[model samples]
Target: MPGMVALRYNPILKTFGERLLASGHAPKAVIGATMRKLVHMIYGIVRTGVPFRADFCSQKLDFQDGI
Candidate 1:
């Protein structure tokens, strides 16, 4: 799926997935989270008519209380 590929090739997402795994999340959970994030990103792109940028988020958004 696209989420898997994103986790494999997208540096930021890959790091996120890896961190989740390290934090004791199951494989399925990681994939589900990844896909969920992809959906949000895609929705944002469609809603705003903006192109995707890897650094669009940068450090402006940080996870709190997991996710």
Candidate 2:
């Protein structure tokens, strides 16, 4: 699955998945959360026309308001 592959190859996604599991999320739920994060990251990049930065982990994105 894309989530599993992301976890294997993407350090950011890997950490996210691990954090979710540590918080008592199920395996499937963690995968789903990672997938959702992947989609949101892609959308944010495209919507903002900005290059992706590996070190970006500041705050939650407010995509609804176009931020």
Candidate 3:
């Protein structure tokens, strides 16, 4: 089932879909959003040498007592 939807599309779409899936996004408009995030992540990692941290995502993280 992995790559099932992507395999049907062109290389561009496949790449977009995979990026979308990797970024925890799944929806009809995932391609565009994923592409944008990919650009930002690439700049952050390559230009700044920083790893992507889920906790620092635009979506705020939940804090539990006594972590």
Candidate 4:
């Protein structure tokens, strides 16, 4: 449910979802990947003891493969 909300409302994930769809990926696969991405992001924040920041997250996404 959180992943679905992120997919709809979060700009970074929204863009990533669009790209995946455009590349012929299945919708379910895209959602699964987005969910994984959200988990990774959450892990990073917890590990760093920092709050979530959209700008910082998007910048990190820039260097990621296929994003």
> Which is the winner by lDDT between candidate 1 and candidate 3?
1
TM-scores of all candidate predictions against the true structure = 0.84, 0.78, 0.38, 0.82
Residue 64 Cα positional deviation in candidate 4, in Å, after optimal superposition = 3.8
Tens digit of lDDT per residue, candidate 1, span 1-67? 9889988998768878888898899898999998898888899999999898988774654463475
Task: Superpose all Cα atoms of candidate 4 onto the true structure and report the RMSD in Å to 1 decimal.
Answer: 1.9
Clashing residue pairs in candidate 2, if any? none
lDDT by residue (1-67, candidate 2, tens digit) is 9888997888777877777777688899888888998999899999999998866762332121211
Q: What is candidate 4's TM-score against the reference?
A: 0.82
Q: How accurate is candidate 2 locally (lDDT)?
A: 0.76
Best by TM-score: 1
Q: For model 4, which pairs clash?
A: none
Backbone Cα, N, C clashes tallied per candidate: 0, 0, 0, 0
lDDT for each candidate structure:
0.82, 0.76, 0.49, 0.83
Residue 51 alpha-carbon offset, candidate 4, angstroms: 1.3
Error of 4 at 41 (Å): 0.3
Put the candidates in TM-score order, highest first: 1, 4, 2, 3
> Using lDDT as the measure, what is the rank order of every candidate, best first?
4, 1, 2, 3
* Candidate 4 residue-wise lDDT, 16-57, digit = tens: 888888889998889988999889888998999998877766
